[model samples]
Target: MSRRVLITGGASGLGLALANAFLGRGDQVLIGDLAETRPDSLPDGADYISLDVRSQQDWDAALAHVRETWGALDVLVNNAGVATGGRIDVEAISDWERVLDINLLGVVRGCQTFTPLLKEQRSGHIVNTASLAGLVHGPGMSSYNAAKAGVVALSETLGFELAPWDIHVSVICPAFFRTNLHESLQGKDIAMEATAVKLITKAQMTADEVAATVLKGIDGHKRVILTDRLGRQAYWTKRLVRPAYNHFATKAGAKLARKTRDA
Candidate 1:
């Protein structure tokens, strides 16, 4: 059976890769993004819809489109989010608001909007693309970390809340990977942005690799999917060895502070 899937922010980056992956699996995919028109970069077999996660009107339109086109959705991927970074004191409140609106509440809106349909059908899956920063916050990313952490927390809550309806919820926490995620980054420090870019560029995994792992995780109904070895190790370290994790976090923070100072 070809499942109907909708992915937000599917115009580029990991979203695009996931769209391609689902298309390869013979799943019918509809990409919802902020793009005014369909981008040529979209996968050949997938469909596109103009969607802005921050807008209620857009979300409502998406739900209508899904109902009219697919009848019922099998999967909803709340993958729309912006990259953000800044020190606690230096970060602008507006940046935090924007990041949280898109990263955390965006998923919330999607789940809220789609849950009714899924509950009515009594089966569905929701995948949220978070980040390793959500699990293991290092430094210089207060806004980003808070937003992603909120996503992790929200996903967990939904896992239990939606279980009665047999609606599976999974949160993807991937470490730095080679994607255009850095392009949406917002911050006051150029050095921090550069460092983020370096980490993203130097990562060994590609969006396709991460997307493959995500699909496997969703198949297994994993609650929290860590897409890379580094992400897993970091998560476990923060979980089982708090002292060591704190030490590393402080050290990393100091290093980042020094770099920002020097820059």
Candidate 2:
């Protein structure tokens, strides 16, 4: 059966990749984005809607469109978020507010608005995009870390609550993949992003590859999905040896700081 899939932040990056993946599978895919979409970026035959994840009115409108058009939603991908980098003390309060509002609260809003529809149907899957940063806290990513960690926690509790309704929840924890997440960075954040790109380009999975993994995880009913080897390593390292993981993270932070200074 062809599923009805809605993806947030679907104009570009991982969201686009995921939308393409579902479209290729013959599912009816709808993209929800704050800005007008780039037609060239998305695959053909995909639908779109204006969605500002921060607003409840936008969420309601998006869902109403889906309900009116398709009658039900089979999958909801809460994949919209931004990356903000700076030392905890240096990052402005505005940065914190924006990051938390979009990354954490955005997911919260999506789940709250869409879960009811899924519950009524008694069948649906919700995939929330988090990050490896959520599992392994690093320096200079205080805001992103807090927002993603909140997403992880929220998804977990949501999974427990929705289990009875057969509305499955999956939290995706992925390592660095080429995406527009870096485009949001500014000032020293740009340097940090550049350093990350240089270090992880070889090892990073493309957004399309991660999208494939997401579908496979959903098909297999995985509760927690890690998109790449690095993400899995980070999760296990933190779980098995916290002290060693923290030591390595601290060194990596120092290296990034030096690189930022030199840049």
Candidate 3:
């Protein structure tokens, strides 16, 4: 039987790759995003919906579409998120709110709306796209780091609460793949952005590679999915060797601070 999968921010980047992967596996795929789409870009059998993740009304409507069409949702990828970075004290409060509203609260709304539906069905997956920044903090990414960390925490809580219902909860913590995520930044921190781009461009994985990891995660019912090897190492380094991780982080942070000042 084909599963019904709904992916937010599915017009491009990791979301689009995920939609394609599910579709290739014969699942009914729905692409929800605020970005404009080209018909050629969408997989031939996939569906698209205009979704601004910030709005509850939009989420309800998407859920309704799934309920009406498939009668049940097998997966909900709360993957839509925007980036905002800068020195915490230097950034505007409103900017931080916007980032949290879309990145963190957006995931919250999806879980709130879909958990009941999936619980009633007694089977489903909820995959939230958090970031490596959530696990390990970096300089000049205060808003993004906080928002993704919230997502990580939220996913963990849901893992416990939704287990009895057979609803799998997975949070993806990816070290930057080549994506438009950097372009989505609303920060004035030029050096931070440049450094981020440099580091990400040096990465070996693509969105498709990360999407494959997500597919493996779904099949294995993994609790936490880390896409990049670096992310996996960092996660362990922080947990198992706190002092070394802190020292490394401090040094990297200082270098970034210098870059930011120069920029």
Better of 2 and 3 by lDDT: 3
What is candidate 2's lDDT per residue for 1-62, written digit by digit as tens? 89999999998888999998898889999999877554566678888888999999999999
Ten-residue stretch with the least lDDT total in model 1: 185-194
lDDT of 1: 0.92
Candidate 1 colliding pairs: none
| Ranked candidates, highest TM-score first | 1, 3, 2
Every candidate's CA RMSD: 1.0, 2.1, 1.6
Highest lDDT, which number?
1
Can you tell me which runs of candidate 3 are displaced by over 4 Å? 35-40
RMSD of 2: 2.1
Write down the TM-score for model 3.
Answer: 0.95
Evaluated against the true structure, the overall lDDT of model 3 is 0.87
Off by over 4 Å in 2: 36-38, 187-203, 256-263
